[model samples]
Target: MDITRYNSEAWDREVESGNVWTKPVSPELVRKAKAGQWEILLTPAKPVPDDWFPKLEGLRVLCLASGGGQQGPILAAVGARVTVFDNSKKQLEQDIYVAERDQLDIRTVRGEMTNLAVFSDSSFDLIVHPVSNTFVADVLPVWKEAYRVLNPKGTLISGFDNPLLHIFDYEEYEKGILKVSYSIPYSDIESLPKDQLKKQLEAREPLEFGHTLEDQIKGQIDAGFIISGFYEDNSAGKEFLDRYINTFMATKAEKVYVDKCRDLA
Candidate 1:
C-alpha cells in the first residue's frame, strides 16, 4: 500500500469533516501576527517559547508536514519566508487559502514528510514540525532530512505522541480503563485487531504509528541535533490517558556543525 497516498486522501476527508488540525487560522490571528503578536502550538497545549525563535524577518522557515493553514500563515505574516510541505493536498490548500485571504507570502509543497528532495541542503533556518509524524512509519529519516536541510545552528521544533499512549486497548481506553494490551513501537496497521482495522478503514481515518521516545528524541540527536529544550503535554480533550499522565511531548533542538573528516578518523 502507498501509505503516504492513503493518508493524504484520509486527511482530505478529515478536512471536510472539520478536524481541528485541518481548520484554517482566522484572519484576525494573522492580523495580530503582522502586528507582532502571535503564538503557535508545537504540541497540543503549550505554545512554543518566544526565545526558541530567532528574528522572524527575512529568515527561511519550513513548516514540515504542518499544513492546515495554521503555523505557516502566522510565520509569513510576521515576515518569515515560509514554505509549508505536507502529504495532504487539502492540508496544503489550507495554507494557500489563508495566504490568499491575508495576502501573505507563503509557498505550499505537497510531498511525503520523509522525502524532502524538493529542498536543497542548508535551505532553511528554522523548521516547525508539529505532531503529524505519528502518521509516518519511520521517523529517523525525517530527522535526517530535517538536519540536512537546515543551516548550521538552525532550530528544529517538533511535537509527537508518547508511544505509551498506544499500549492501551482502544475499547478499554474509551471506558476510562488503561489496559496494556499492546507494546511500545505500535502500529495500528499491524497491531490493531481485524475488526478495529476494518472499522478504521470504513471510517476513512488515517493509520497511525507509535514510535518510542528513543526513536523520537534520540533520533534527532543521532541526526546531529543538540537537544536544547523539552516539555510534556496532555491531549486537549478528556481522554483516558489525559487523566493519568501527559500523552504528548515537544522538543526544541539545534543543528551544530561537525567536521566530517575528523569524525571519519
Candidate 2:
C-alpha cells in the first residue's frame, strides 16, 4: 500500500467530514491578524512564543505540511508572503478558500512534505511546520528538505508528537490507562497486528509513525539547523494524557552556514 497516497486521500475525507484542522479561518480572524492581533500553533494548544518569531511583514514564509488554512492565511494576513504546502489537496483548498475570500496572496502547493524539490534552495526565510511529521516514515528527509529551502539564518518552527505517545495503546488512552503495547518507533504498517492493520485500512485511517528524538530533534541539528528554542504542549482533544503530561513539543531552529571540515591528515 502507498502510505503517502492513502494518507493524502484520507485527509481529503477528513476535510469532507469537517475535521477541525481542515476548517479554514473566519474572516474575523483574518481581520484581526491584519491588525497584528493573531496567534498560531505549532503544537496542539499553546501559541508559539512571541519572541520566537521574527517580524512577519514581508517575510518569505512556508507553512510546510501545514495546510489547514489556519497558519498560512494568518501569516499572509500579517504581511508575510505565505506558501502552504501539504499532501492533501482538500486541505490546500481550505487555504485557498480563505486566501480568496480574504483577498490575501497565499500560494497553495500539493506535494509530499519530505520532497521539497519543487521549491528552490533557500527560497524561504521561515517555515511553520505543525505536528504533521508523524504522517511521514522518515522525519530526517523532512528536516533536510526544510533546511535546504530556508535561507541562511532562516528559522524553522516545527511541532511534533513525543515518541512517548506511541508507546501505549492509543485505544486505552481514552480509558485513562497507559498500556505498554508498542515501542518507541511505532508504525501502523509495521507495528500494528495484521487484523488491526486491516481494520485501519478498512476504516481509511491515516497511517502514522512514531519517530525517535534522534530523528525528530537531532535530525534537525544533523541537517545543519541550530536548535535555539523549545517548548512542550498537550494535545487539545486528548485530555486524558494532557492532564498527565505534555504529549507534543515544538522547536525553533535556525539554518546557518556551517563549514565542513577541511581534511583528516
Candidate 3:
C-alpha cells in the first residue's frame, strides 16, 4: 500500500497501536531469547526438535531484523556464516553489540525486509524471521523476496502473533473478542511523529502489515518455494485461526515440502 510514503511519525503510530512495534525491545528482553526458547513459549501440539537449526558448518544464513542479534549469534556460534539485515539503526546497533559480546561474525546491513533483491537469488541456505512481519503492512512482498534470495532447498523459519489475537483489546478483557473491532481485510494505518518520518520509511511500510497463513503459503509458492512447515500457536484459538483462513488460507494446504534449490550464481 505504497509503503514507501511512511515517515517516522507514521512508524510511531504503529508502535503506539500496540499492534506492530508495540514496545521497544530492551536489551534484557533480547538477552532472554536463548536457543530453544521458541519451543517453550510458542507451544505446538507435538514437540519440535530443540536443535531445529541444521548443522551450520557451511550454511549461509540470513537473519531478518537482527533483533538484538540474539538469534544471529547463536547461529554463528555453531559455525554458520551469518548475515543480519535490519532497517532500524538502533536495533542493528544493539545486534552489533550482542555480536561483539558473543564474538560472532554476523555481518549487518541496513535494508527493508520486503526488498531482499539486494541479496542475490539462491544465495542463502536458511532465513529466520521471528515475529516481525506485523511491523510491515504486507507480507507477500517479504515472502517473495525471501523465496528469491533463498536457495531452493533453503528453509525459512518465522512466527507472528495470531491474527485472532489482533481482535482483542488487552486493556479491556470484555472488548477482546469483538470481531467488528477491525475490518476482516485489515489495513495497517498508523500515525507517527514528524521527526521520525525518515526512519519510519525505513522501518515500516504505509500499508497494513498482517497476512493469513494461506496468503503466506501462496505467496511463497508463487515465488517458487515450497512450504516446509506450518505451525500455529494454539493459544490464540478459533478467532485468530478464522481470520488467518480468510486472509491467508481459504484452501487447505497439501503436505508441506522442503527441497534444495541449486546455488545462486
Q: Which stretches of candidate 1 lie over 4 Å from their true place?
A: 261-265
> Which regions of candidate 3 fall more than 4 Å away from where they truly are?
1-51, 169-179, 190-208, 234-265
Q: Which is better, 1 or 2, measured by lDDT?
A: 1
Backbone clashes, candidate 3: 20
Query: For model 3, what is the error of residue 22's alpha carbon versus the real structure, in angstroms, after optimal superposition?
Result: 11
Summing lDDT over every window of 10 consecutive residues in candidate 1, give the lowest-scoring window: 235-244
After superposition, the stretches of candidate 2 with alpha carbons farther than 4 Å from their true spots are 259-265
| Residue lDDT tens for model 1, 1-265 | 7888989999999999999899999999999999999999988777988988999999999999999999999999999999999999999999999999999999999999999999999999999999999999999999999999999989999999889888999988888887899887898889999999999988989999999889999999999999999989887765667877898989999998989999999
Models, CA RMSD each = 1.2, 1.8, 7.7
TM-score rank, highest first? 1, 2, 3
Model 3 Cα lDDT, one tens digit per residue, 225-249:
6555655444334333443333221
Top lDDT model: 1
Candidates' C-alpha lDDT: 0.93, 0.92, 0.55
The numbered model that scores best in TM-score is 1
